[model samples]
Target: MIAIIDYDAGNLTSVERAVRFLGEDCAVTRDLDLISKAERVIFPGVGAAGSAMESLKKYGLDKALHEAMKAGKPILGICLGTQIITSFSEENQGTPCLGLVKGEVLCFPDDMKSPEGEKLKVPHMGWNNVTVLKDHPVLADLRPEHQFYFVHSYYPMAKEAGNVLAETAYGLTFSSVMGRDNLIATQFHPEKSGKPGLALLKNFIAWKP
Candidate 1:
């Protein structure tokens, strides 16, 4: 069974519903034992980074999650869930994260000054298009320019370009999906992205560690 981690963050049910729609077994629990035993673990969140990190620590979930990942199980993180996998985040007073991936979570630059100098809206809400950048199992059947639901102001800047599997253009292009070993994360809400999203979830479920 797949495990949808429960940590009082919003959108957990939405994720669970999507999993059930795919006709798969998923358990939503905070129990570390269940998480460790699951074939694939999903960490979904939509909240303040500092608060989330505190909750994770309070529940001793940080260690549990790390143990699961270390055991070479496939893990997927969404939204703030994705951010926590990174080394640290500048959001919510700069909280230290899971350190599973070598990167930092940051907000859109106030000056809007990249080499490209692109200007777009903040939060990057609603449906946005993501272009495939690298090949990965999570994106097995997904095509370039697939539309996915997104709702966030902060984005991930991967330290290594090779870690980026998909890019999406907002004020400027940013990492939409990142993959490293058994770890996979997406800034976009695949659970709400319709058929393409469901396909990706199915692929994740069938992914081999």
Candidate 2:
């Protein structure tokens, strides 16, 4: 069973729906015991960084998440969920993150321009093609130019370049997929994405490490 952590973060329903579509037993809960016992835990969010952190702390989910990671259980974070895994975020400017991964979320500079002379837009909404930078089980059967849905302004900057598994161009190439050990995260919204996105989820469900 996969446990979807519920702490008032947005998009829980979509994630749960996808998990069901994958024919997997998934439960959405705030109970730590359920989360700890689940085969995998997915953290999905579509909101501000600081508020999400507060919600996690309020329900003691943060500690549960840390413990799960320590146990080497698979944990996947999406979008804002991915941001919180970093050390800190410039999203709310003073917000601290889960620090599970060494990185920071930063907004694109207004003057940032792509190689094609297009000014990178904020809240990078729409379908963007992701270029897989490295091979991993999460991206096992995924094609190189897999299109995923995205809607966010901040992107993660890892301290070590190898942490980045995929890169998407938005004015400049940013970390689209990050992986380490039993953890995986994506800045894109797989639930919002179509077939390819669903495939990625299925891959994650079947992933060993």
Candidate 3:
């Protein structure tokens, strides 16, 4: 069964629904045993990193996640889930994160401009296409035309360049997908990205690593 971790981080139901829609058995729960026993874990969330970390520790999901990663379980993170999996985030006055991945989450610069000299908006909300940097099973079916939904001002930056799986361009290019060993994360919300997003989740469900 797939466990959709519930840490008061928004978007849990949406991810659960998406998994169920794909005919996968999943549960949105904070129960430690459920998460530890699940074959796969989906860590998807929306919200501030500081509060999210508070909730994660409050339920001890942080340790559960660390254990899952160490066990080589196929773990997927989305958006805030993706950001907080790293070592730290510039949000909330430099909040420390789960440290599952060697990376940092940084906010976009205040003066971001598009290539055409147009001012780009912060909190990069909307659809964006990713440039796959390295091939991985979970992203095997993704095509060049496929775009994913993004809604955040901060983006993850892996300390190791090899961990960067994909990148997307906004005012500047940023890591859109990151993975190492059994853990994979997306800066975009695959659960809300329509067909392409579902394809990603479907691929994830079938991924061996």
Candidate 4:
């Protein structure tokens, strides 16, 4: 069974529904034992870094995540989950994060603008395409034309370039997909995205790494 981690960060049900639609057994839970035993774990969230960390600590899911990573479990992170897995976040007056991946989350500059010189908004919402930087099984089926849903003000910057899997441009290009070993993460929401998104999730479900 796949464990969809629950720490009160919104967007849990959508992920659960998507997983079920793919005919996979999954549960949104805070049970440490259940998380540890699950074949794979989906750490998905949509919220502020500060409050999310507080909830993670409150439910001890933070430590559980570290344990799962150390055991080489296939773990997937989305949106807020992707942010907190980094070392720190510029959000909430500089919040410390899981440090699972060597990187920092940074907010987009206020004066950010598109290449065409058009002003781009913060919290880059709606559909955007990602440029795959490195190949991985979870992203094998994704084509250049495939776009994913995004809604975030901050984006991850990995310390090691090798850790970057894909990048997307709003005002500027930023790391959109990152992974190492058994862990993979996406800045976009595959659950909310259409066929391409579902394809990514399906690839993840069968991904051995």
The TM-scores of all predictions, comma-separated, are 0.93, 0.96, 0.98, 0.99
Ranking, TM-score, top scorer first: 4, 3, 2, 1
lDDT of 3 by residue, 110-200 (tens): 8999989999998899998999999999998889999899999998999999999999999888889999999999999999999989999
Global lDDT of each model? Answer: 0.86, 0.89, 0.94, 0.95
- Model 2 clash pairs are none
Error of 4 at 101 (Å): 0.6
Which run of 10 residues does model 1 get worst, by summed lDDT? Answer: 111-120
Q: Candidate 4, residues 1-209: lDDT per residue as tens digits?
A: 99999999999999999999999999999999999999999999999999999999999999999999999999999999999999999999999999999999999998998888988898799999999989899999889989899999999988899999999989888889988999999999999999999999999999997
**Model 2: how far is 179 from its true place, Å?**
1.3
- Model 4 stretches astray by more than 4 angstroms: none
Please give, for residues 1-209, the per-residue lDDT of candidate 2 as tens digits: 99999989889999999999989999999999899899999998888888999999999999998998999999999988898899998978768999888888998788987787877778788999988878898887678666899999888877678889888888877888887889999999998898988988999999887
User: Taking the tens digit of each residue's C-alpha lDDT, what string does model 1 give over 97-151?
Assistant: 9888889888886656435765656777899888888878779888765789999
Q: Return the lDDT, model 3, position 170.
A: 91
* lDDT leader: 4
TM-score for candidate 2, residues paired by index: 0.96
Ranking by lDDT: 4, 3, 2, 1
lDDT of 2 at 48: 88
Candidate 1 lDDT at 79 equals 89
Show how many residue pairs clash in every candidate, following the order shown: 0, 0, 0, 0
